[model samples]
Every structure is written in structure tokens, then in C-alpha cells.
Target: MTVRTLFDRCRAFQARMPLAGFFSHSTAAVLHGLSLPKALEGDSRVHVSVVAPTRAPRGEGVVGHRVDARPSVVLVADLQVANPVAAWCQTTA
Candidate 1:
């Protein structure tokens, strides 16, 4: 899918969630303008995470993570996204 379409999908997914989790992993990396491996450059899945006590989101085209600690978040393209350090660690994992 095109980048604009992917972003619209992510927005829709977040809208369905009760508490919108922050975008993480590859998704955050893209939002932050970080370089990604070629394998991940075209991935369309939205990576989202919520801190513990809040259940991880689940849906088509989404990879969800339940983190024990609250991650630092920043606004990117009007979406909540994990900070660079947290996103890097998540990508490695």
C-alpha cells in the first residue's frame, strides 16, 4: 500500500482503540525519519504499544506490544509515537 494509505489505516486503527497506544518499532522509526533495513522499508503493519495494565491492541495489520514500563512518547504527523531510543530498542527486539 502507499504511504498515505498506510497512515490512514493507522489512524483508523487508533480510532478503534479505547486508549490509543503509541506507534513503536518500525512504525515509530518511520515517523521519526530513521533509516530502516530494506526488509522493513515496505512493511505495512502498524506497530503499537501500551504500557502494562493497559492491554495491547489487536487487529489486522497491527503488531502490538505490552510494555512493562511507560515509554517516552512524542507527536509525529499528529500521531503519538515512541521516542527514538525506545523505538530503536523495540526494533532490535
Candidate 2:
């Protein structure tokens, strides 16, 4: 599937989620149009960062991070995605 298709799928996945969090990691990279490594290409898990007190959303295909500071974010196709810089930082750590 193409990036557009992946974004649509992410949007759909976000819609079904109850907790509020911005997409991070490879998911955010895709939203920001950043090229990803081959290993990440097959990662269907959605990466998200939630507020520290609230637990990260859990499920079969989701990777959640608990952060004390909420990172900046932007909406892509109506899905909340972490900003490129913050997402890049997240990916680095």
C-alpha cells in the first residue's frame, strides 16, 4: 500500500481509539513524509505518546509511550500526529 493508503488506515485506526494521544515514531514519520528504514516498513503497530499520568493506550497493534511533557503535534487527515522534529527526537531515543 502507498503512503496515502497508510495514512487513511492510520486515520481510521485513530478514530476508533478512545484515549487522546499524538502519533509518534514511524507512524509520525509517515505523516510528516519522512523516509523510513526498511525494517519499519512492515511495522503495523501504531506508536503514540500519551500524558504521563494517563496510561498509554494498549492493544495488539499499538506501541505506547508515556511522556511527562506533551510534544507538539499537528493534524494530518484529521489524525493527531506529532510534529516532525519531536517525532524525529522520539525515533532517535
Per lDDT, the best of the predicted structures is 1
Clashing pairs in 1: none
Note the clash tally of each candidate: 0, 0
**Cα deviation of 42 in candidate 1 (Å)?**
3.9
Model 1, position 90: C-alpha lDDT score: 74
lDDT of 2 by residue, 7-93 (tens): 776776786664768888888987788877777778777787888898887777778888888878798878888888887776666
Best by TM-score: 1
lDDT of each: 0.80, 0.78
For model 1, give the 10-residue run with minimal summed lDDT.
Answer: 1-10
Give candidate 2 misplaced runs (Cα > 4 Å): none
